[model samples]
Target: MNNVKGKLIIIGGAVDKGSFTEVSFDQNVANNLNFFETGIMKRIISESKHGEQSRLEIITTASVIPREVGPEYIKAFAYLNAHNVGVLYIEKREQAHDPEVLERLRNADVVMFTGGDQLRLTSILGGTEFHDILLDKFKNEDFIYAGTSAGAAAASNNMIYQGSSSEALLKGEVKITSGLGLIQDVIIDTHFVQRGRIGRLFQTVVGNPRTIGIGLGEDTGLLITGNGRMEAIGSGLVIIVDGRQIKDTNLTQVELGKPISINNLVVHVMSMYDTYDLHTHQMEIRNSQYSIPLMAEQDSDDADPKVSADDRE
Candidate 1:
C-alpha cells in the first residue's frame, strides 16, 4: 500500500476565536461566527468532502479540561454550519476500546484532536482498537485526520513529548517517545515559533539524522498528502528541519547531560502558499514567480528568514 491516499491536517494551537473586546456585536452571533477565517481549523473543515453534512468526531482526551475543550470545538464548527459534531470522551485506555466509541469513529467523516498533553493522548489511545481503526480508515478511506498543538505532535512516530528551550540541544534534555504513529519518518513539534521550540527540533533531527522534523507555528499548519507533498497554510511559518546532509556530529562523544553539536544541517522556513516535496527535498513558492533561496539560519532566537551566510558566520 505504497500509494495509500488520505488527508492529514496538522495544526498549531491558539487559533483566534475572535476578539472579545469588539463592541456592537451580539455575544451569541460573535460566538458562532467565523472568527479565524485564515486559521488551520477552518481549513480542516473545508478539506472534508462532506461539507455541511460532515460527521465530525472531536477527541479531547489530551486536554486537562476535556469538558470545556470539546464544547469550544463544537461551537467553532457549529459556526461553520457543521451540525453533526460529536465528542469521543475517551479519558482512559479502557474507554478507548469502547464499542460505542469505535462505532462513532467508524461513522465519522472527520476525526479531530484538540490540544493538551501529547503524552497523555498517545498513552490513552495508543495500541487500542480505536487507534487501529482510525489508522485503517486514514489509509483506505477518504477520511480526514486533523489536530492542533499536542494533537498535531501526536501524529508522528517519534514525538517530542517534553523539552524546554533553555536546555533543548543538550544531550538527554530533549525527551522523545512513541506517538500515535499516524505519520512516519518524522518528528513533530507544535506551537513551535510561539514556544521557541526550534532548538529542541534541531536536536531531534540531529539525533535521528534520517528522520525529518516539522516545527509548526501557532495558527499555521501543513496539509500533507500520503505521497509526502506538504502544502503550508495559515499566517505563521512552518519550519522544516532536514538532517540528511548534516556532518561532523559530536553527539556520540558528549556525555548524556552535555551539549550536542552538529554541522551543515539544512533548514527551510515556509509560510502560506509554500509547497514542499518531502520525497525529493524540494520547495516551491506558489505566490512568487521567480525562484528564491529557501535556506534559513539555525538560530532559534531569530525566526526571520536570513538572506546572507555572513549573518550567521
Candidate 2:
C-alpha cells in the first residue's frame, strides 16, 4: 500500500442523471437544477481541496462518445460552480500521449473520469507519459481522483470488463482485465445492487482470494483515505467481498461451464456512512446508533443463479 496523502471518490453511474430542463415539469426550470445534482458529485466537489478555485480536468477518454460525454460533465460541473473545469477528450492512444494534455493533467487540482468503457481507458492511457504523471500526482499530492461507472471500474488493478449478472457465478464467466493500476489488489464494479452484480463480485474474490471486491451502488461512492480504510458515502450500498478465509471449495474440481461451489465466502453489505477497514477485513460502524449486523456467508447452493464462462478472452 502506498503512503500517499491523496484521496479517491469512486462513484457509481447514472448518479443524478436528470433529463432536460424543458422536459421536466416538476418545478420552475431554473429551480429544477437540483435534479441534475447528485450526492456523489457534490461530495467529489467538496473533496477537491481548493473549493471554488479547483481546476478539474474531466477525462472522457473511456467514453465511446467522448465528444458528447465531455460536454455533459463540463456542464454538470459548471452547475456546481466549478468554472475552471476542462475536458481531456482523448479518443485515440496518440492523443493520450499529447504533451499539452499531460501538462493540463499535471496542473489540474482534480482529474475526473467519465463513464464509458473501462477497457478503452486502460488501453489508451496504459503506458503513456500521461498515465505516469497521473499516478505520481495521485501518490505525492493531495489530489483527488473521481470517476463514475466505467470510470470508477478503471480505478483499480483488476477491472471487470464485460459480464452480465445472470452469468456471473460460474467460473470464468466474469471477465477481468488489467486496469489503470491506480488502486492495487482490488476489483471494482459499478451499478452494483441496481444491476444485481453481487454474484460477479463474489466470483472475483473467489478467484483471487487476496484481492478485495468492492460493489458500488448507483449514487453511491467510497472514499478511500490512505490505503486500506474506506468510508462509504452517498445514498446507496457498498458490498465488500472478502475471500481471504475460505475453508472449502468445489470451484477447482468443476469443469468449465459448470456451477462453482464454495463453502465460506465472507460478504459484507454496507450502506452510506459505513466505514470498512480493508487491512483488518472488518466493518466499523462510525455511528454507534446502528447495530452491527452479522456478516453474510455464501455457499454453492444459495438459491440464487449458479454460474458460466466468459466468452471474451
Candidate 3:
C-alpha cells in the first residue's frame, strides 16, 4: 500500500467538468482550469515534488452514471510532472464494479474522489468491500488525498446531500447519511450558493449544534494539512457553520414538515488565501506568497531533477 501522510484538498464542485469538451487535450491548458491560482494548491503540488508528500492517486467515486474520466483527470499529473512529481490512476471496469478496484485503492499515494450523485456514490461504494480497503489505505505516509462536490461530502463521517430529489433546503429537508469518514465529524455540502443549500446546511448545524458544517461553493475548495491547519483557496469563499458552542436551537420545536427559523448561530464566510486553524476554531488571513523570501520559496521547492534521492538536501 502507498504511504498516506500528506496534505489534503477537498473541492466543492466543478472538478474537470468542462475540459473534456475541448477539442485539444492540452495538458497545461486543461490542467490550469482544474486547479486554482492560489498558492496553497500550488504548495500541495510543490510539496509532492520534494517528497514532502507523494503522488496523487485520484479516485472518482461519484457520477457513476457512466461518467467518463479521460485525459483531463490526468492534467493534475501534468502539473506535477512539470514540477517533477509522478502520478497514476486506478482503472475501473465500465458499467459495473471491479473487485480488484479495492486493492488498487489501498495502495494509492493520493486518493481523490470525483463529483456526482451523493446517494449513488454511497449506494455503490459505501459499506462495500471496496470502501473498506480504501479505509485501510488511510494510515500510511508520502500519500495525500482529495475530493470534489459529492466527493467532498463523502469525506465526512456524515454527509449532507440530495439523493434522488431536487429538494431545496428547508428546516427538516436536509438529509444526512453515513460517509467514508476520512475527514470525520463534519458534514459537507457542495455547489452551495448556486444550489441554494445554505438553508439545508443551516438545518444541519442548527439541528445538531455540535457538528461542524462546511459548505463549499462551486470552483472553491479547502486546502488542509494534517496538523489541523487549512487554507481556503479558489475564486470564492468557504462558508463555515460552527455549532459546537451553540446555546439553543429550536430544530426539534418544529415538526418534521415545517421550516424552522434559526437564530443566534455564528457563521463565517472565509476568503481565499485565508487560513482556518481547526484546533483553535479560529480564522486568520494567511501570509501572502509574495511575502516569503526567494530562498524560502526555492528551499521549499528544492527537488533537483538531475540528482538522486540520496543527493536531496
Model 1 lDDT, residue 167, Cα: 89
lDDT of each: 0.81, 0.78, 0.62
Query: What does candidate 3 score on TM?
Result: 0.73
**Winning model by TM-score:** 1
Better of 2 and 3 by lDDT: 2
lDDT by residue for model 3 (65-161), tens: 3234534455555654532332223233331245455555555566656666666667666766666655665544555567777767887788876
Best by lDDT: 1
Per-residue lDDT of 112-159 in model 1, one digit per residue for the tens? 887788899999999999999999988888788898778899998889
**Alpha-carbon shift of residue 88 in model 2 (angstroms):** 0.7
Q: Candidate 2 — which pairs collide?
A: 170-307, 170-308, 172-310
Worst 10 residues of 1 by lDDT: 17-26
For candidate 1, the per-residue lDDT at 261 reads 86
Candidate 2 lDDT trough over 10 residues, lowest sum: 18-27
Candidate 2, position 223, lDDT: 88
Candidate order by decreasing lDDT: 1, 2, 3
Clashes of each: 0, 3, 8
Ranking by TM-score: 1, 2, 3
Would you give me the overall lDDT of model 2?
Answer: 0.78
